[model samples]
Target: MNSARRFLLSFAACVALALGMAAPAAAQPFPLTFDAGWNGAGSPPLPASGFWDVQANWNNNFQAGTSNNVSPYAYYQETAVIGGDLVNSVGDLIATFAPVTVNVRTFQDTLGTSASSPAANRRAVAGVLVQNGSTLNIQSTGRLSVLVTYGTNGATTGLPTPGTGSVAVESGGMITIQTSGQLNVVDNIDINNGSMTVFPGALVTAQSINSGAAGTIALSGNASLTSTGSTTLNGTTTISGPNVVFNSGQVFMGDSTVFNPVITGGTHSIMNVNGPVTMNGTLRPQITGVTPTLASSWVLWDSTSTNGQFDFSDDSLTDLPDPGHRYNVATTTVGSVHGTRGLLIVENFLTAEVDRATGAVWLRNTANTGGVNITGYQISSASGSIDAAGFTSSLDDDNFDGG
Candidate 1:
């Protein structure tokens, strides 16, 4: 009876083996979880080393929540270095539900040589969605790159559109890039919260930037921001810095634009705005030099409106006007000047004044030989009173209306 029972048991075991049911269960992939700690309620530290996308070192449960449909809340506070690409295949890579502070650096040397290499250092093919009443603090001495997008899962496969997520760089915490690093954002960037500060040496290439409604982009200490493509502005954007160079492909200012920079007269570093600029604020040219004349012609307004005018109602020149140089407001269309109001005050040491009213160009000069020469548009204003300085002013014969 015992031998029969053993034989029956062996037969059942053999059958189970043949059916592939006796094999050990496969190991579940490790989810990237940041509990209180590995032991639950201790200081959490970053993993020694691993690829950002590896399941063994990551806890996918942390990304699940009401706002994000992926993972639950996880407290993340650590500084780590990633040696591989941090690509996200799920929905927006969100870090919320906790006061999260992560200083991440990527290994650039291991990144492949191709332009589209997934292992490219400091570059994230996925979009970083920071919202839901959460703040993400990132401070990187090495190159840190991210692709800003919206509405799609944070994937590293395609271009991104503007979404609800925002990336705010905390004040004094910087993302420094060496070796000509370029941080690209496909949509508009908001710096009005005053929580983010782009340092002087950092280079960011973006499509557009909104200096929040009452925000100011203070470019102090020789900081610079260059736009690789056309950009649009929607609020009151103020430029208050010294020797700050803002290079844009084309800028369309939808609201008031203010320029209050302390620039040297002959310096080649000037603010370059390549599109139609609608001046809704006071533009004060603060040029400084020994014989500081506005010679560089820095402010270029290429307007398409035939009646486009620079309303310098509140502008004051801080330096003398150079006789040999003409401050050109280069425009495309040609017609009678209109829509101009207020005093176009170009006051100089020689006390020469050039004013542009509706369809008229008025010049009052007290200096001799060197006068204001108007070009590119027809001057239709009646002659004004000449001053006692024996100064002369000339309007281009081709653009003069003889009114």
Candidate 2:
């Protein structure tokens, strides 16, 4: 059966069981709580081996056993006072058998003074799989780190493939990496139809991020994501969604890499990049309904350095605003524009100008010459002007014969 159907069935079973049970004559029993440690008084300990769902060791540490599978439809609402760790010494931390929800609230522990203490052991091995509608929520005011890595074996015979054993935050559910929480994935994070929210003061680092067409990642407050590799956006997805606002923090999209994400203007939403933004793909800045003035329109690239290139090869800058409105793509230093077959259609007027003092703009055609295909380029300004400045050709034999 599908994941959604399975989750519904499991939830129904839990409700039925709760309803069938007789209520206590006095007070209701409290929910089970698991403290951070291998052994403690009145603490629900984890198991040592076998499946994690086994009831033999209910007061042990939460360890991912050799089977690498947890109980299906199991929900753990853990209020950890000293913080808990989910260690995996073997294969991937798979939750595919059933949908599991882990609500973890971590606090400061006074056990050891070293960096690697019992509180610092909140980690997993061979990556984490939240597929089949599983959800992992981590809320903390202190540090809570989880690093998903591959074993000593290579990818050929490794327990999980490099960048293959991804943390799937599938759709219809939520996986929250709250403030003071850090989750580093060695592989790609596939946000396939799921909702993953990274709150401010939290860090989520991954090799790459493949956001599905229907998946939504709400990067709000001061939350930051550092992608060591590339981030590919598929389907019809926007960087900002309802209740999703990105006002602060830097989202470093690697160095000298072309990162493309479809962006739309919303409340306090802007595409803010700190390093060089080399966009070889299309940057669809949707302009409809509202008029886009110079100050109110979207600012595509606000680079901090001079070595950035905005390549518009096979790109389309669509739905340009009406007359008297402008869409600006500005950088601090030198910014280059490449248009092999790309088109910039404006409804009124379009000015591709650069700051004459601190910066320079380069516009070149497919041959890297002054020749540009602005044949159908129409500007609603008086005289319909098309200005091409700072033109230079590398071909020694060719000459500029016409004015």
Candidate 3:
């Protein structure tokens, strides 16, 4: 071989090594932060930490897994049920127009072909639209329910039930997701001007329904709504996020939406709202049952400002325990047995019936325990009556305890 030939070979080898090192690494999704704050600017590059902070806020009941995550920084106004290995982070959400229900499964097999089981994946979630960072808006209007459950208790295999990622609605656009589910948001959801109902397990028809359940669903600016319901009992669920608004017609209580396996819910149920608000309803805000109930539990349903009017009618609700049922309604004070509604109802340990459709109050389930202690609410519009005897404050058999 000649000297020139050897030199040429060496130069070529060096060039190959340089090129290899210059190549960039593979790119990941958004949420590149420990606290998940996208800096309120443009979304930065994403790492493998598992976060959706850069573009929009998120909500779920299952504990999100991400050892390196900050539990849940900030709060996603979107209402969703999530459960996974979450660290120290605050949930982001809003519950003025609707409430996003989350039932995060703590553990399950995440490497299976399909989800956990057929029954475990037929659950439902309801709430309002979502939004985050700039115009990255993803509306989840109407009811967003999924048959998503973790296979663990009494179950054989353990798998993550990545249920159908479909935001079932009548008109909102639709799209399939990578695995989770899809979203649906119509331009408007007013009962008067607009009327459409999407059954469970259906597809959405909103503008931009995505195939991922981890993005922003903002409804900001002039985005105002009445937050109606599919049924009389389904209208009480309100969950969303951001500086959003829930105009005057905003009310709760009814069955337009539902939450099966009533586990736990309430305003403290994790509902975050911005802008003015108004709340109205008669259904139980939160549910904590050992057996499992439907249409119960909530994260947040705030309506504290006077600017927002809260209308409450004891009759606008349905499916509630009737005379034959064991359940009852009563008002109670902290220390005392039965408190007072001042003018509301529920005398000390008394049973009363609340008309959800007419806002009327009556007496029922007089065969129960004392009245449920009314923490610290004395404001009354019109006092109600309570049946003595059997009027208990702490009992669950009153609603579903079939005779």
Better of 1 and 2 by lDDT: 2
* Collision count for each candidate, in order: 12, 9, 128
Report the error of model 3 at residue 30, Å: 31
TM-score, every prediction: 0.43, 0.41, 0.23
Highest lDDT against the true fold, candidate: 2
The TM-score of candidate 1 is 0.43
What does candidate 3's lDDT look like per residue over 20-129, in tens digits?
64322213111111112111212234332222221222322222222221212101112231211223234533222122212122211122222222122222222222
Q: Candidate 3, residue 292: CA error in Å?
A: 11
Q: List model 2 lDDT by residue over 133-243, tens digit each.
A: 556666655333223222121211212222222466656545677887666555667777766778877777777766665666666555667666655444232443223
Candidate 1: Cα lDDT at 349: 24
Model 1 Cα lDDT, one tens digit per residue, 1-403: 1123323543554476678673322231011112210111112454533223222233322222212221111101111211112223256553322323333343222323332222232134222332222222322343334432211133322222222212333222223333233344444455443323445554555566655443345443345676655544433333433455576655554335444444554432345555434544435455556354343334332322312333443335564543323222333333212221121223322222355232233433333334445443332336754332443446544322221
Best by TM-score: 1
What residue runs in model 2 are displaced by over 4 Å at the alpha carbon? 1-100, 107-122, 142-166, 171-173, 235-291, 294-297, 302-403
